[model samples]
Target: MPLYKEIILKDNAKLYLWKITEDIEYLKHAVKLNTNSQNRVDSMKSESHQKGFLAARMLLQHIGYTDFDLYYDTFGKPHLTDGKHISISHSHTFSAIAISNQSIGLDIEQVKEKILKIASRFMDVSHLENLSETEKRIKATVIWGIKESIFKIKNIEGISFRNHIFEEDFSLEDKKATATLKYENKEENFDILFDSAEDYIFVCAFEKQ
Candidate 1:
């Protein structure tokens, strides 16, 4: 699958989204890697992961980094070797990569109705009550995307969706939302850019300061 879009943000940040297709073998070949022994029996899973990683690395290279080595922090958040803030998220066959000088968080998820089942875990009463019935499910997915981005930026695990991840109202009219990080006693705000297209939705958050 090729990249669907490349967004250039205000501060030299780049957001790349790659479409996923059903050709698992082709994707594996694109990465020039053989499936791992454990994943050999599951070609689909292996290919999806490989393709996402390869596409992300290519984006990193375009920004002047030749080597792409990903290691997780203590919280299991993936980090780049040189300390740049990078976040990756993949759902189904689609993958997204976001990199910036400022700390960043990004997430990509296939738009699906299943999100409705878990909406309460991530959204507050106010957020939930505001959505129209038709829009509520879609909004749930968007909230999930924001939460994922928040998690990657904080590089911390154990935060619950209901308690920690909070958001200001997002609108399709404006394509923007605000998320807050409440840790200890301080609050930090981040801007969220949302793109919803053809069965998929992506969200990215960045520290404005």
Candidate 2:
């Protein structure tokens, strides 16, 4: 499970996913990491986290990038040295990245019943109307991913998922959506694309042009 999938969302934007099926030792030797990345990996307490980090590097390499070409800002947002927009996300067993000429955000989350318990916190419960229990979970997870993606793009403080981001009504059949980010007298719109695979939902948010 090296590169799970590569999606050309637009002419200038692409997405990559890496399935973390290799052991840490295998990954350690499979990819090359910069000193900073090596130290960061060494500081990780959980093997899962280390593997996720390594898998992200592997995905970057698949796109002709290495850890040396990536860095994080003060807000912990990742950027490429070549002035490309990059965003990264990792859940339990998968890591993903999106690179674009313009700003973009990417997020992946496992579909779990637990999101239903916190549905009220992040999304409009009414949006979940007329759907089965399974649909509810999927919708909730997508909405959560939507907000997370937007947050990554903005990476601003005081941005509460429940309070700042808003998603419009959408259906699973559409496989697409839109969201608004309203914070601190600033308003922005995003084009959203999403799909589910193997019980995981990944969402991509691109700044409206």
Query: CA lDDT, every prediction?
Result: 0.70, 0.93
- Residue-level lDDT for 123 in candidate 2: 92
How many steric clashes between backbone atoms does each model show? 0, 0
List the candidates' TM-scores in order.
0.80, 0.98
Question: How high is the lDDT of residue 67 in model 1?
Answer: 33
Over 4 Å off, model 1: 32-47, 58-74, 81-83, 128-132
Best by lDDT: 2
Considering summed lDDT, which 10 consecutive residues are worst modelled in model 1?
A: 32-41
Distance from true location, Cα of 137 in model 2, Å:
0.4
| Candidate 2, residue 182: lDDT | 94
Write one digit per residue (lDDT tens) for candidate 2, span 135-162.
9999999999999999999998889999
Q: Looking at model 1, how many pairs of residues clash? A: 0
Query: For model 2, what is the C-alpha lDDT against the true structure?
Result: 0.93
